[model samples]
Target: MEKKIITISRQFGSGGHEVGMKLAQKLGVKFYDKELVDMLAKDGKYNADFIEANEEKCSPPMCPVMPGFSMPVFYQDLPSDLIYKGQSKLIRTLAERGPCVVVGRCADYILRNMNPVNCFVYGSLEARVNRKMSMIPEGLSFTREEIKKRVIDVDKKRAKYHEFYTDKRWGRMEDYDLCVNTDKVGIEGAVETIAAYVEHCK
Candidate 1:
């Protein structure tokens, strides 16, 4: 059987990363997440920290976070288009390398032609907040209202960033092979369900 690529687009605190990790382990394939930033940094000579800080988020005014800091202008400067171009290029490179489970980074649209198993993971506000609370460090504490607000803000930014980079609508069922509600089914259940779906796809 041909190796399959799995692209998981997930909401904040939805356990998408955990699910993706489990899926990769179950299938014995590599997983790509923040590792993508390191790969991009090596290929593009861009700073890894810079990429991580801005990964999957749009600049508010469409301005570079650090003025005048970017990859060397390849030819004519496509200033406005540079980050999107670089990010898309990086995503393409990773997908081409092997069968991997990619979390976020818009892998769905980036590898659209690769016959990837695309998934979207989301949950209700209360579920998401509870998950976030569990993941928080011991000393740091936040009210339920604060956690809920943070989740909304992060997901909003992700949606905006995805929309800005791709023509296809994000979170639409048509764009994905499977849409799992983490609230309805917990993380491990979501992972097992996806594993079964992947086997069927094969």
Candidate 2:
């Protein structure tokens, strides 16, 4: 049997990560998300904080965060470019190893040659805001307005990162094999739908 890979690109507060995790579990495959960042940090001998901060983010032309000052000496070079290259390499390496569900980091584009099932998950603003609010800690105070702003900001950053790296429009339906609106079908339904597709593909 041929290996199958699922790459998910999600909007903030879209519950895409939850769906991806559930799908991977149901499919009995490995899942990659923040785990990829940790792996890169450990393998590259980079500060985890530095990798997290710059991962999926394009570098400013002016080098806003100077190494040995704002950043560690290990990150003195072109850190953003290195981060992109490192993660891209890791994504391809993992895909070659076996089947896995990779969330974001342009995994869809990175594994394009592998004919992976690329999914884009998005939700209505109202649904996204509610989802974000529900995830906040009980004692934490976050208004709906604040959550909405956060969602927009995060989506914008993701779009910019995708465009910068792949030159493809983020969340665009044409770029994906499946485009799901979690607001309509809910997370569990979305997972079931994608899982069925995966099974059929096999």
Candidate 3:
């Protein structure tokens, strides 16, 4: 049987991870999300905390002010750059290993040569906020406004990270093989739709 790889890129509050997991299960394949972080940390001998912090974040520009003049600063390496390299390597390695569903970390771009099916999952802001808030545990106490802000912040970070690493706009429909609107189709519907697309691709 030919191996198939599915890469899911999602908006912050969209249940993309859940959809990816369900799709993988329905297809009898493995799922990779936070597990990619762990694999990168282990394979690259990087600290887990550092990898978690730098993953999907763009490093701030460094500027050093000098007395009477500003000196040009050139950076050989940044933590975000290192993390991206490690994670990219890990993503490609995993693609080579077998069929699986990988979420985020620019897996789509990394596995371009493997003919992975790239998917983008998104939802309306109101729908996303409601979904996010529902996931909070009881007594966690996050207001709707707070959830909205968090969703915005995360989406911004993800967009920046994608542009920085892949030089491509994130969430653009043209870049993905499929774009699922979870708010419109619901999670199960989105999963079924993507599964059908994957089958057709094979």
Candidate 4:
């Protein structure tokens, strides 16, 4: 049989990471999320911390964290582009090995040739805000309004990042094989539904 790969793209505050991790555990396969950052930085050319913060973000021409360092004017050779190239390579290697669940970094688009099952997870703003508040670091405190605004901001960055790399609008239902609204079905329901979709894949 062919490889079983699932790529999950999610809105900020959605439980896409949790869902993907659980799904991978349930399927007895490997999982990739922020781990991709460490892998990219493994060669030591890139800073792990910087890549972690900027991997899913889209800010052009210069480093977001380090203001002075700037990528060249050319789009293809931008810093994020370099990271995308590295990620695309690593993602392909992972998918080629066996069944796995990959979250973000435009893995769906990167592994399109491998025919991975691409899923998008989203939730209502209210649900997302609640989720985000619950998941916030213990030392950091955010008011409900603040969390809601941050949720929106994060989704915007994700969309921009995806478009920058893939030239496709993020969170569009048509681009994915399955789209789950976590607000409607909850995280477990979304996981179960996606699990079923993967099983049914030929």
* Candidate 2 regions with alpha-carbon error over 4 angstroms: 1-3, 63-78
Candidate 4 residue lDDT tens string, 1-202: 2438999999988899999999898888999998888888997878897677667776566423344646433344566667778888999998999889999999999999988899999988898988888888989988999988888988888898898888688998889999999999888999899998888888
Measured by TM-score, how close is model 2 to the native structure?
Answer: 0.89
For model 4, the stretches where C-alpha displacement exceeds 4 angstroms are 1-3, 62-76
Candidate 2 local lDDT, 1-202, one digit each (tens): 2348999999999998999999888888899998987899888667789998888777765435555586543433466778888899999999999999999999999999998999999999899999999999978998889999999988998898999889689987899989999988999999989987777774
- Ranking the candidates on TM-score from highest down gives 3, 2, 4, 1
Clashing pairs in 2: none
State each model's C-alpha RMSD to the native: 5.2, 5.1, 2.4, 4.5
Give the candidates in order of lDDT, highest first: 3, 2, 4, 1
Best candidate (score: TM-score)? 3
Per-residue lDDT tens digits for candidate 3, residues 1-202, read: 3448999999988999999999999998889999887777776579789999989999875655457666545445678898888888878877888999999999999898889999999999999999998899987898899999999999999999999989679998889999999988999999999988888895
Candidate 1 ranges with C-alpha deviation above 4 Å = 62-83
lDDT of 4: 0.86
What clash pairs does model 3 have?
Answer: none
Per-residue lDDT, model 1, residue 2, is 48
lDDT of 3: 0.89
